[model samples]
Target: MATPTVEKFLLEVSRVLRERNGPQLQDILVIEPPLPPLYNLMVNELRNAFPSGQDDALEDKCTRALPEYVEMEDGSSWTAFIKFMRQYFCFLRDVNVENLVETFQLLRNLVKQSVNALGHGSMGVVLLPTVIAFSRALTKLTIALHKKPQLIAHLIRRQAADESGSRSTLVDTAADVLRDAFSGCLNDRSVTGAGVGSDGRPMGKKISIYVIANLCLKLYFECDKIRSAEQIFVNIQNGSPPLSLYPASQRVTYLYYLGRYYFVNNHFYRAQLALQSAYDGCHSKCVQQRSRILPFLITACMTLGRFPSQALLRRPEAAGLAEKFLPICRAISRGDLATFRSFFGPEGPHTDYFLRRRLLLPLRDRCEVLVWRSMARKTFLLAGSQGDPGARKAPTFDLHDLLRLTQVLERRSFGQTQKKPIGKTHTNSIFMFQNSQQNGIKPELYVDPDVKGVAEPAGPPEPTMLDIESMVSSLIYQGFLGGFISHRQLRFAIRGAKEKGSLNAGFPNVWEVIKSRSSDAVPGWKRDEVSSVRNGVSRPPGPGMVIHLSGARPAGTPPM
Candidate 1:
């Protein structure tokens, strides 16, 4: 009952499998939505012959219609491929109708059979290319389903009861599919040695781990289920070989997500390490990706008190970022509390941008301490009397001086965000009633004692001495300041001014303090390991190879 074209296609698939041709099998099993002409023709033939209203009958129909189907041969080993192919055809038919419920079900089966093909001996390894192709198709469909929330709800309702009775999205289901594939690749025992594949090229199905993982990570993040991605990192770190063995693009992307994960968990130092590696390894031509990374990188550096340079801000990838970050950086450097609040506060121009990126709250909280440290530094410079160089007592500034500065900055900050009355200009409103009352006379303005007696509405509580004291004490405790506060005298004195210079002793460098407290190694980042074998040969660099150039002149150095 098979059409001539369908029969020829099935026979060609069987021939490719028999020959163990991975690339050919991949082409024959193309499964991205809107199937290829060959696949479309096959599905159309099957639909005409055996139509199922809403059931899984492709197998039954194939069994009856094509009894000579190649997989039906006794002792045949192409079972998984045939199953995956049928499911893929069904998926393409249903996808056009937007039958998400049915399409997801088919996707689940396709993932299962693909993973099975990976586990089935050397033949499975030959199918690795096909598995990768299927994974690409899977990632697209999964992400597409995730973007439509209404379909997720509909799929949930029409599907069977859940064991956990909790809600789930199609992307989460796809993650399980991808995770199974990832585990299959991770546990691939066919690797001849560490980081080397079976066919002797530093390659194998294990090379597919990050490919699947990066896809799964994409889904988790898109679904706002980032915490669920922790196991992916844990598994790779505990068992997978050095990440440098992988391609650079994969390393950059994985590190990017890893950095973002650290950022969300409040590990700013670790976040900087991961993001810095990602940004450096990323190709210069990848402008959009580098741009995606810069905001987080820039923010992380700012948290550690290292501001972006003019050259960095001028990079093509950093376009529009200067408008967003430069003002805050200037405020932090200049101790301009009013400017900081105007830009980061609720009425700030970039508030929407910051909030959209989830940066508003963290920036407001963390960088305020840096601002206070700057303010304290400025206060010492302006008001403190530098005692004699040989004086035993350290240089000190009165708390009252800091208090006055704090009050002025706080009031100025409050004034910048004040809202004016909605409708009238001052002159138009103050004289409008006069013109209406006396046709053409300009009414003399008089102050009303009753109105004056009513106190003006209070602004933000002026920064009190207690607030300033507590803030200075915090800066000292956090190691941003190398000083201590005196309770009785209400003054802050540098601890080592007699031995170390006043400026050096009073304010410790922010980056150095942070770096000292953190470990040097970053989890899941591999920088040194290199693969020893490729394609069954040991190919070390030749002696004359221009590998390391320690003697090379640095950029911008004048040549002698």
Candidate 2:
């Protein structure tokens, strides 16, 4: 005999089954316990019925709500979903919440069952909502696992499902399950069902690819398994529809991860493109989302010599970012190496901030090159011969002149700190100033700027002649300087200064130089021209070019 509460639950399930209401059915069959009185009622019913072996009677009523087989096509999805829900009920009743590892595996198998149904006739429409729900459950499982760091060792061992002979973590295995789900959506063959839309795009279940993909990416990044994320990007570029067809939320999330992938591989140009699109497409009201995108976007922009403006830093999303990046900008602009190193060095105040984002070494290395260019340009402007037509000569500056300017900047940047310590303890200044103040007299101190003829200071060593030459050569080689180093004269001279003026002939714009060398196409980014069919092959979308082989060897030749 069924209890009144058990009978009422079964009646509701039957009603949902008859009306084909997936969301309501999903709500009823949640793996976790329901809220408030329902939770207490379900727990009490399970506790009282299980020990007496009367639970089988209640289970029978749950089973009878949906029959084993339905002759009608409309009942197929319903039948599949109800079967999954019954398993959810069993898990909720029996699962040990304390053992999250075991609990995660149970939920994983349940979601895997849902993943399998994604391929059955038209069941994807019915099971996808549950699939996303279970996946979130798995996410919570991983988060819980992260809190217990000691238990991570247990997760580090290879599971029976992983055949690669390498260890896996809780998040890694969850990503694999989600990858399988993503594949089910990507590989759907149904025409009118969930495969392609009327506009010739991935529709229905296929639209869930990015949703599942974003989940997998989140896990992969957390577990330090970035290489695995690349394969997902490749699959989307090959088969998925243009990203614009998806909702704004999905597009923003996918592009953010894609931009980060490019960034880790040192592809700043591509990183900037993806991140810029993500930032622009994101909703203006989503402050947290915009905040997450700005760090990588700012780093990429700075690498390409485009600094963020003051107005941009004043936005709510950019709070505290100015303190970390502003010093670097001012250092680059003023060509101050000491200030740059003082703020961003290994022992600097902002070191931990940049280190956490993995931006420390890259910013330190790549931005230093721009600093050299600034120093060189400043030296030329101050000392190089002016390109007045009356002079009729190329603009030239001595290497010694640049060396002097660099030393002056370094000394000034570090001078105050070097003198502060000694002044705090020294006798002459403190005694003399205190006596004069007691007598109501003011003391004035002045020193000539040209007093120091030697390069002695309490900081980094001065740049040598060889270092200056190498920096100039590098700038010239990279096309930042439209000039050549005159080794014999130990000077840098612009090629067409007499005709085009010094600034035009000697220094090129940093953005233009970097832009000309960068490729326009980023592999996973979507554009207007990409086709649904992609001409029967998967290739990067953009203008195609050919490579010429030099010194080709004949086929099957064995000699070296």
Candidate 3:
């Protein structure tokens, strides 16, 4: 039964070819072919039957042949189908220059309907292949329409869908078709200068390049290949006619995407530079757009460890802008917890939401702020005890305090004393100074009666009394003269040493006699016979006074 049906179909196709006026030609050619060989034969027969000199009929015949072959399920059939369509479309392209406008219009309409059907979930296995065929056909049509402004406008209208409606899926499907078409055209390099310019000359559509780049970027970003998106941006930048060749607004848009790509990849330095350029390139008239750009700029600055420009921060025009970003800077500097929390809040258009939530906010609030606050407290304590007389008595900063603080701030469960003591050398210096003051002593006053009697010849006997209290007071006074110690503490140290007699006992009797003789202007006390007289005594020296009685000095003392 299938063989006879196929035979009857073949006979009808042959009859149409001979008569060339069959009303059912379109219907007959569009019927499903039976097998791979029969499919190829039918396609070849249709191709040969395309009317000569009648370009419209030839295109219609080829167009009608598309739906038939595109329905095949087998891979071989699909491949052959694609090959047949490509050859047929290329033939239409070459021969039907005048009739190309109407041919593309009809083809675009057919594919658009197919696209809509596929989007509505009407087509199942056939959808993918249909998309591929529609894409190929659209590419030829779009290229043909490039020379016809009326046709170009018509195609655009046909392609337009309700952008704000549930048309994204449709747009996406159409975008897929457009993407494949552009890819094919780019591969062949034949689409260049294929479109007609307003000047009525063939020119490449500059807008298409931007559209292609944007599509590629979107595709790559959705796939999470941020690096490839960045590379595409680089290519866009280094193109022969640079991205800057576009108008400022378009250029700004390009830079905007380029900057975001860098930002997403953590290329902060490049991101900052690119975003700054974009922000500046966009005019002030676009306040909303400027607002959108500001956060990215702020983030870029922060990541690069740079502060925002003063102009931006201080400008009255940027009031809301300052409110948005200044807290981020302050939080970073002071390690403030509340500010950090607000920075990562769920309200704004933050780019690195996950990082802020998972890492930066928690780290700052839970760890960094606590660590810095502890350090500040330690510094204040150290500064408070700068100078104390009994430095060892002063409480020193502790290493364990710092280490324990560190553990607490970092949320770690460890408490061990630090190996090195805090301010060790400084504490030691203070201790040594204290010990030296304790060991120091004062000199005693001594007077010799022998020298006192012989000093009558002088106008006045020089005072030989040593004021030990005064001498010790001078030393202690000098030590604490800086007003670091209270007067009561100074007096107590002096009085304590004197009461112990350590101050007076430090002087020797012989040294006292020498001092007394020197007071009386006696030249040599050691050589004088008074020294022998004093040495002869075995008993303890008298408490009141002792005079050395030398015979020669006694006779001439008054006279001398």
Cα RMSD for candidates in order: 12.0, 11.5, 39.8
By TM-score: ranked, best first: 1, 2, 3
Order of the predicted models by lDDT, top scorer first: 1, 2, 3
Q: What total of clashing residue pairs does each candidate reach?
A: 0, 0, 0
Per lDDT, the best of the predicted structures is: 1
Best by TM-score: 1
TM-score of each: 0.80, 0.77, 0.34
TM-score pick, better of 1 and 3: 1
lDDT of candidate 3 over 165-242, digit per residue (tens)? 443322234345454433332232322332334654322323234545554454444434456554454443333233
What candidate 2 gets wrong by more than 4 Å, as runs, is 1-20, 33-36, 39-65, 68-83, 157-165, 192-196, 199-202, 387-392, 404-463, 496-500, 530-560
Q: Kindly give the stretch of ten consecutive residues in candidate 1 with the minimal lDDT sum.
A: 61-70
How high is the lDDT of residue 293 in model 2?
Answer: 95
Clashing pairs in 1: none
Candidate 2 residues 400-428, lDDT tens each? 99988877766765663454343235457
* Prediction 3 global C-alpha lDDT: 0.42
Give the C-alpha lDDT of model 2.
Answer: 0.76
Q: Which ten residues in a row have the lowest lDDT in candidate 2?
A: 416-425
Q: What is candidate 1's lDDT per residue for 1-560, written digit by digit as tens?
A: 65666567666766786687988888777666566677777777767764656334665543433344334445555555556556655655555436765666776777777787678645667778877777766777777777786777756775557666666566777788888888888888776555565543346677777877888788788778899989998888766766777889988999999888888777888898999989999988999999998999888888888889889999999999998999999899889998898887666889889988877776777898899999988999999867666656778888899899889998998888776333344566654573443645434544466796677668877888899989998888888999888889998988888777888889989988889888967675544443455678976874223465777898999988
For each candidate in the order shown, give its overall lDDT on alpha carbons. Answer: 0.77, 0.76, 0.42
**TM-score between candidate 1 and the true structure:** 0.80
